[model samples]
Target: MKSLVFRVFAVFTLVLVAAVSGCGQKGPVLNVYNWGDYIDESVLHDFEKKYNIRVNYDTFATNEDMYVKIKAGGSTYDVLFPSDYMIKRMIDEDMLEKLDFNNIPNYKYINDSFKNLEYDPNNEYSVPYMWGTVGILYNKKMVQEKPDSWGILWDKRYAKQILMMDSQRDSIGITLKYLGYSMNTKNPKELEEAKQALIKQKPLVLAYVVDEVKDKMIAGEAALAVVWSGDAIYCMRENPDLDYVIPKEGSNLWFDAMVIPKGTKRKKEAELFINYMCETDVAFRNTDYIGYSSPHTEAVKKLPAEIRNSRTAYPTEEDMANCEIFAHLGSMLKEFDRIWTEIKSN
Candidate 1:
């Protein structure tokens, strides 16, 4: 028995040493870019330990920023986490690699509903990471009445106490919805209305922010804020006085998914990391820490019952019936950019 154990250990040591020495080369390093504060991060170290690959992780604040960097053409990133519309744009531009699903067998664990999404109808270029809705996250103690409409944000009573998203798509898209238009509308007239509405409300807005919305809302610095459902969950947990509501008018339903860039030499290594991320245990750790909704069926089963069943985390179809998924705006996007600049400058 002692001889057998010693022999097995010797063989393992020889194979491990040969893996790095045989090629006179070091292990691969994969560059991954994703949203800030979006992952558990510890999982990256875990993946490194398990696969003998080093990860170089960086973060971007918004999808547009990410798109600009990658579009400028020097990024060495192997993996990315971009929202739906951006993914569609990347696919159309031939910026992404067609994923070989065979390398990511764990793809089967993702919920069927999250598959064949509008952006990747054939599931060709991306894997669903986290999904959620956009809504009003407000402090119950600061408001005289519950906020159920986006119109409430313009109330003079809440002037200088309302936080709005800094992102062009979310702020303007929500306004478009509030004005009884589609969040993805390309009509210049509708966009003008949305722009004017935002300009009108700008004086009431305390600030246009992103991640700071969570900290501000938690500290009671603002009475109300526009936030993603995941951020709302995190804020609500820290300060129970906070509550989130999907407006009666409508809102955008959005998600960020993982994809590989077309030029990556580390394609296999990238796929390995993606597969590792989808492992039930790894997926559970990410969602649990990030306060985001996981599309992994097995990981969803592992979440705490309270969060797993919370309507905020997983809204029923009726609640989301009116929600629109943003599509790639193409030239119409320039109109949005112009409007966003005007609103901010005003």
Candidate 2:
């Protein structure tokens, strides 16, 4: 009788400890993974406090890195922000979960131009986050006159003072665009022409970088560099003389979107978060923090006049007509990657 009583008492103590531990624990938790420095920290803190949910934020350097980790399986990422091309690739691989729109009531505020994109047609998979173009961020005083052509990147006077993107895809794609070929072109001759152009310009470059364009440009390390729109905005703020312009030879119009990863346990919570982010004010806050253009029309209207009117932030419609977004090229990616490695190796 004594042994039985002790066993029963021990089991009851264990059960009580488990129940107390569960109650003392925090509220719902959401894991959000995104690009580094991509969004405002205050916004995240505010979201967490408002919903009483713990948000475990994480970041990745590139889309490829993000894709590899998610593909490993059983990773718990409720939301992911990736470029259009990556989103298309993920969807093709069935790696993304379908979004439930009912929870995302603010979806209607998105601009029509950014909606129903080719990658997520019918609006089933993702929500557009930010959209802008790749262009030249230059120092106006050094150049004297604004460059209107891609050829300016190879100007002899700028030799050893020019900077270029370190990204293989973006660098090669821009070169192809400058040469009047499709960024996704598979033509061996066209690609070779672009390769030659890159080599000719390589000697002129100070450095090839992805994340340091703002710092280097601010410090006047390079007179000019190929930069994404968001980085250009931040760079302009870093130096009063700096300016951003889309080249006459055309440029890449890139778009990023938020999508739920496959097998996310908190599907409803994920949708709610997406909807919250899509709100006009919330989108504006994100753009202001990251220095990017907001694809949400309502959000754009809410921006300060200086930001909305700035040419670097909101290019005229005519400028936009000259840009193109990258598309998934299936088998050609390996070839592009091969050429990219060759360029870096040499």
Candidate with maximal TM-score? 2
- Backbone clashes in candidate 2 total 0
Relative to the true structure, how large is the alpha-carbon lDDT of every model?
Answer: 0.92, 0.86
Report the C-alpha lDDT of model 1 over 74-189, residue by residue, as the tens digit. 88899999999999999999999999899999999999999998999999999999999999998999998988889999999999999999999999999999999999998889
What ranges in model 2 sit over 4 Å off? 1-25
Which tens-of-lDDT digit does each residue in 1-346 have in candidate 2?
Answer: 9999999999999999999767637777788999898898888888887788778799998888999899987678999999999998999999899887888889888888888877888889999888888999999888878889888888999998899998877899889988898887889999988888888888888999888888989988888899998888888877888998998778888888999998888888888888889877789899888888888889899888998998778888788776777887788888887887777777
Evaluated at residue 88, the lDDT of candidate 2 is: 89
Model 1 weakest 10-residue run by lDDT: 20-29
Error at 60, model 1, angstroms: 2.1
- The TM-score, computed over Cα atoms with residue i paired to residue i, of candidate 2 is 0.90
